[model samples]
Target: MKWTDINDIAIELADSQPDTDPLKVNFVDLRDWVMALPGFDDDPKHCGEKILEAIQQAWIDEVA
Candidate 1:
Protein backbone atom coordinates (compact mmCIF):
# COMPACT_ATOMS: atom_id res chain seq x y z
CA MET A 1 0.00 0.00 0.00
CA LYS A 2 1.08 3.54 -0.68
CA TRP A 3 1.33 5.59 2.52
CA THR A 4 1.37 9.37 2.34
CA ASP A 5 1.36 9.98 6.07
CA ILE A 6 3.84 9.20 8.86
CA ASN A 7 1.03 8.78 11.39
CA ASP A 8 -0.20 5.66 9.62
CA ILE A 9 3.17 3.99 9.92
CA ALA A 10 3.43 4.79 13.61
CA ILE A 11 -0.04 3.45 14.16
CA GLU A 12 0.71 0.16 12.48
CA LEU A 13 3.91 -0.44 14.41
CA ALA A 14 2.01 0.07 17.65
CA ASP A 15 0.32 -3.22 16.84
CA SER A 16 3.64 -5.18 16.84
CA GLN A 17 3.35 -5.84 13.11
CA PRO A 18 6.29 -6.31 10.72
CA ASP A 19 8.33 -3.50 9.36
CA THR A 20 11.22 -5.30 7.70
CA ASP A 21 9.40 -5.73 4.43
CA PRO A 22 9.15 -2.32 2.91
CA LEU A 23 6.02 -3.52 1.15
CA LYS A 24 4.42 -4.61 4.45
CA VAL A 25 5.76 -1.74 6.49
CA ASN A 26 3.56 -1.40 9.60
CA PHE A 27 5.11 0.68 12.31
CA VAL A 28 8.15 2.63 13.42
CA ASP A 29 7.88 2.99 17.16
CA LEU A 30 11.17 4.61 18.05
CA ARG A 31 11.13 3.68 21.72
CA ASP A 32 10.23 0.06 21.09
CA TRP A 33 11.87 -0.45 17.72
CA VAL A 34 15.16 1.35 17.96
CA MET A 35 18.27 -0.64 18.90
CA ALA A 36 16.56 -3.65 17.38
CA LEU A 37 18.61 -3.74 14.19
CA PRO A 38 22.20 -3.98 13.00
CA GLY A 39 22.29 -0.49 11.61
CA PHE A 40 18.74 -0.23 12.68
CA ASP A 41 18.25 -3.77 11.37
CA ASP A 42 14.69 -3.81 12.68
CA ASP A 43 15.21 -0.68 14.68
CA PRO A 44 11.85 1.01 14.86
CA LYS A 45 13.43 4.30 15.88
CA HIS A 46 15.52 4.58 12.77
CA CYS A 47 12.73 3.30 10.61
CA GLY A 48 10.29 5.75 12.12
CA GLU A 49 12.68 8.59 11.57
CA LYS A 50 13.25 7.55 8.00
CA ILE A 51 9.54 7.35 7.23
CA LEU A 52 8.74 10.58 9.04
CA GLU A 53 11.52 12.36 7.20
CA ALA A 54 10.35 11.03 3.91
CA ILE A 55 6.82 12.23 4.60
CA GLN A 56 8.08 15.64 5.65
CA GLN A 57 10.25 15.91 2.59
CA ALA A 58 7.41 14.90 0.34
CA TRP A 59 5.20 17.55 1.86
CA ILE A 60 7.87 20.14 1.39
CA ASP A 61 8.39 19.14 -2.21
CA GLU A 62 4.69 19.20 -2.89
CA VAL A 63 4.48 22.85 -1.86
CA ALA A 64 7.79 23.80 -3.40
Candidate 2:
Protein backbone atom coordinates (compact mmCIF):
# COMPACT_ATOMS: atom_id res chain seq x y z
CA MET A 1 0.00 0.00 0.00
CA LYS A 2 1.19 3.44 -0.87
CA TRP A 3 0.85 6.66 1.13
CA THR A 4 -2.30 7.43 -0.81
CA ASP A 5 -3.97 4.34 0.62
CA ILE A 6 -4.85 6.21 3.78
CA ASN A 7 -7.78 4.11 4.99
CA ASP A 8 -5.97 0.83 4.41
CA ILE A 9 -2.96 2.04 6.35
CA ALA A 10 -5.21 3.29 9.13
CA ILE A 11 -6.97 -0.07 9.36
CA GLU A 12 -3.67 -1.92 9.55
CA LEU A 13 -2.43 0.41 12.25
CA ALA A 14 -5.62 0.08 14.26
CA ASP A 15 -5.47 -3.71 14.10
CA SER A 16 -1.74 -3.90 14.83
CA GLN A 17 -1.79 -1.40 17.69
CA PRO A 18 -5.17 -1.73 19.29
CA ASP A 19 -3.86 -0.42 22.61
CA THR A 20 -2.21 2.65 21.18
CA ASP A 21 -3.83 6.05 20.83
CA PRO A 22 -3.50 7.69 17.47
CA LEU A 23 -3.74 11.19 18.94
CA LYS A 24 -0.66 10.60 21.05
CA VAL A 25 1.45 9.42 18.14
CA ASN A 26 4.14 11.75 16.87
CA PHE A 27 4.79 12.08 13.16
CA VAL A 28 8.21 10.41 13.28
CA ASP A 29 6.94 7.35 15.07
CA LEU A 30 3.79 7.34 12.98
CA ARG A 31 5.84 7.39 9.83
CA ASP A 32 8.00 4.56 11.09
CA TRP A 33 5.01 2.52 12.14
CA VAL A 34 3.42 2.99 8.74
CA MET A 35 6.62 1.93 7.01
CA ALA A 36 6.86 -1.11 9.25
CA LEU A 37 3.37 -2.30 8.36
CA PRO A 38 3.23 -5.39 6.20
CA GLY A 39 2.28 -4.75 2.56
CA PHE A 40 3.33 -1.13 2.90
CA ASP A 41 5.37 -0.23 -0.14
CA ASP A 42 6.00 3.36 -1.03
CA ASP A 43 8.72 5.92 -1.38
CA PRO A 44 9.39 7.38 2.05
CA LYS A 45 10.15 10.74 0.54
CA HIS A 46 6.65 10.83 -0.92
CA CYS A 47 5.16 11.35 2.53
CA GLY A 48 4.59 14.77 4.02
CA GLU A 49 2.77 16.46 6.84
CA LYS A 50 -0.56 16.40 5.03
CA ILE A 51 -0.33 12.68 4.36
CA LEU A 52 0.63 11.99 7.95
CA GLU A 53 -2.19 14.11 9.22
CA ALA A 54 -4.65 12.27 7.02
CA ILE A 55 -3.35 8.91 8.14
CA GLN A 56 -3.56 9.92 11.78
CA GLN A 57 -7.07 11.19 11.33
CA ALA A 58 -8.06 8.00 9.53
CA TRP A 59 -6.59 5.88 12.30
CA ILE A 60 -8.49 7.81 14.91
CA ASP A 61 -11.64 7.37 12.91
CA GLU A 62 -10.98 3.69 12.44
CA VAL A 63 -10.64 3.14 16.18
CA ALA A 64 -13.67 5.21 16.93
Candidate 3:
Protein backbone atom coordinates (compact mmCIF):
# COMPACT_ATOMS: atom_id res chain seq x y z
CA MET A 1 0.00 0.00 0.00
CA LYS A 2 1.08 3.52 -0.78
CA TRP A 3 0.61 6.82 1.01
CA THR A 4 -2.89 7.36 -0.42
CA ASP A 5 -4.11 3.96 0.71
CA ILE A 6 -5.37 5.40 3.98
CA ASN A 7 -8.23 3.04 4.71
CA ASP A 8 -6.26 -0.06 3.87
CA ILE A 9 -3.32 1.03 5.96
CA ALA A 10 -5.63 1.92 8.86
CA ILE A 11 -7.18 -1.53 8.76
CA GLU A 12 -3.77 -3.10 8.82
CA LEU A 13 -2.70 -0.91 11.70
CA ALA A 14 -5.88 -1.61 13.68
CA ASP A 15 -5.28 -5.32 13.31
CA SER A 16 -1.58 -5.07 14.05
CA GLN A 17 -1.94 -2.84 17.07
CA PRO A 18 -5.24 -3.70 18.63
CA ASP A 19 -4.19 -2.58 22.08
CA THR A 20 -2.72 0.73 20.92
CA ASP A 21 -4.56 3.98 20.64
CA PRO A 22 -4.28 5.63 17.26
CA LEU A 23 -5.09 9.14 18.49
CA LYS A 24 -2.16 9.04 20.88
CA VAL A 25 0.37 8.18 18.20
CA ASN A 26 2.74 10.84 16.97
CA PHE A 27 3.42 11.36 13.29
CA VAL A 28 6.97 10.04 13.47
CA ASP A 29 5.97 6.77 15.16
CA LEU A 30 2.86 6.49 13.04
CA ARG A 31 4.96 6.75 9.89
CA ASP A 32 7.33 4.12 11.14
CA TRP A 33 4.56 1.69 11.99
CA VAL A 34 2.97 2.22 8.60
CA MET A 35 6.28 1.48 6.90
CA ALA A 36 6.72 -1.62 9.01
CA LEU A 37 3.40 -3.03 7.85
CA PRO A 38 3.68 -6.32 5.95
CA GLY A 39 2.14 -5.17 2.68
CA PHE A 40 3.30 -1.58 2.86
CA ASP A 41 5.45 -0.70 -0.16
CA ASP A 42 5.59 3.08 -0.32
CA ASP A 43 8.51 5.46 -0.16
CA PRO A 44 8.94 6.98 3.29
CA LYS A 45 9.47 10.40 1.78
CA HIS A 46 6.11 10.19 0.05
CA CYS A 47 4.18 10.30 3.33
CA GLY A 48 3.20 13.60 4.92
CA GLU A 49 1.17 14.98 7.83
CA LYS A 50 -2.13 14.89 5.99
CA ILE A 51 -1.74 11.27 4.99
CA LEU A 52 -0.75 10.25 8.47
CA GLU A 53 -3.67 12.12 10.00
CA ALA A 54 -6.08 10.44 7.65
CA ILE A 55 -4.62 7.07 8.49
CA GLN A 56 -4.95 7.77 12.20
CA GLN A 57 -8.52 8.91 11.79
CA ALA A 58 -9.34 5.81 9.81
CA TRP A 59 -7.72 3.64 12.42
CA ILE A 60 -9.80 5.35 15.10
CA ASP A 61 -12.90 4.61 13.12
CA GLU A 62 -11.81 1.03 12.53
CA VAL A 63 -11.26 0.43 16.21
CA ALA A 64 -14.44 2.21 17.25
Model 2, residue pairs in steric clash: none
RMSD of each candidate relative to the true structure: 11.2, 0.4, 0.6
Q: After superposition, how far is residue 30 of candidate 2 from its true place, in Å?
A: 0.3
* Candidate 2 local Cα displacement, residue 8, angstroms: 0.2
Give the poorly placed runs of model 3, Cα more than 4 Å off.
none
| Clashes per candidate, residues 3 or more apart or on different chains | 5, 0, 0
Comparing 2 and 3 on TM-score, the stronger one: 2
Q: Residue by residue across 1-64, what tens digits does model 1's lDDT show?
A: 1233344433444333342333333334343442332233333323345565564443334333
Give the poorly placed runs of model 1, Cα more than 4 Å off. Answer: 1-47
- The Cα local distance difference test for each model comes to 0.39, 0.99, 0.92
lDDT of 1: 0.39
Please give the range of 10 consecutive residues that has the lowest summed lDDT in model 3.
42-51
Write down the TM-score for model 3: 0.95
Worst 10 residues of 1 by lDDT: 36-45
Clashing pairs in 1: 13-27, 33-44, 37-41, 37-42, 38-41
